[model samples]
Target: MAQSVHFSTPVDTVVSRMRALDTALPERDGLAVFNRVYLTVTEEFDRQLDAGLFPDRRAAISLDVRFAERYLTVAEDGRAPACWRPLLQFRRHPGVRPLQFALSGINAHIGHDLALALVDTCRTLGCEPADLEDEFDRVGDLLVSLEERVREELMPGPDLFQIADPLTHLLGSWSLERAREATWAAARALWALRGLPDLAEEFADRLDSAVGLAGRMLLTPLPI
Candidate 1:
């Protein structure tokens, strides 16, 4: 047999898949750029989970895997909802910076996939969205740190940048903290609407379109 691999957990499985992508894609490839960032996040989640950082480990694992699977699905098939199209479609454009790709992917994943993942986790665990609040907050804290790094490393330095810069406005406009809060609210709303499949689908569709719009804006090619 050419392959015989076993994952210790679902997190491990995703981590491995991400590692594979990281290795397979070109260094400058847009998905590769985002893949590296996401891999770091997933690894941190796994480490924190192992260290008992999350109170409900099972719920955390479920949510983390569910959320990641959404992105992986798009990555695997090259077919995704509107929310993911901007990043995947513009991935190879030279004008789109690595930071843009990274943030765009995060925007789609957190703004759209994450909310649905929360509802998925709630149903899988036979619980409600409130039960996963701790995990949600914990992950949000991680994304906040990621956002901070994106700015520090990607934004222009004080010597070169002005207050009226478009890039400055773009970076400032996107906030993971606000996105997390909105996703939490969305998850609650989605869980409530689960009983009404038609309405829920419509709501989800609108959300997908809105997130795609945000993602497309984030990916606006710059002269940088």
Candidate 2:
């Protein structure tokens, strides 16, 4: 089940909560690894918002906050899709590389949470996913940019890229571009399923499990 959040100011609330998590969680914790990446993105988005990059700031903020809330909700309620389960469950495992932790969170959030967030934003705005396409594209671009940083900051040294390197192969398998496209399609499908809650839940569950499986593989507790 999703946790209920009461935000007097949606954007500020989400950003502050993420910052708080950043301060509270250990630097090496899996969730903390992802939190750092997400916090950077959120700060950038807030800067962009202040600069008037979004045409409908209110709508964009609503979407952004709602999207973030999905991830945070999982942290609070522990009732998350299978996709996020691995990250939460392995947060304290010293064997998982920070890169793996970061990517696993990205997979869970983009692969599953983003689709649901789209539906949530649509409901709040009385609009459709198409109506928020610009915001989605903008946010996706930000996330993609962050992935490059993730690679640079977390990828092992050049000496470790041998043919037998499991980390290299694991990181190579996932692509932010492909994830974004799939997420968009999933969002559309989920929106279409809104009228059938049971079917929608089933679809969401499958997505969760599939992404979770990928995350599990990524967090294979390599010899790094």
Residue range 66-157, candidate 1, lDDT tens digits: 99999999887787999999888898998777778888989999999999999999999999999889988888888889778866776666
Please give the range of 10 consecutive residues that has the lowest summed lDDT in model 1.
155-164
What is the alpha-carbon lDDT of model 2 when measured against the actual structure? 0.87
Q: Candidate 2, residues 1-224: lDDT per residue as tens digits? A: 97544334567778898898899888899999999999899989987887779999888998899889889988656677688989989988877889999999998899888888988999988999999999999999999999998989898887776523788887899988898999999999999999999999999888888889988888888774
TM-score of each: 0.92, 0.91
lDDT assessment of candidate 1: 0.87
> What 10-residue stretch in candidate 2 is worst by lDDT?
2-11
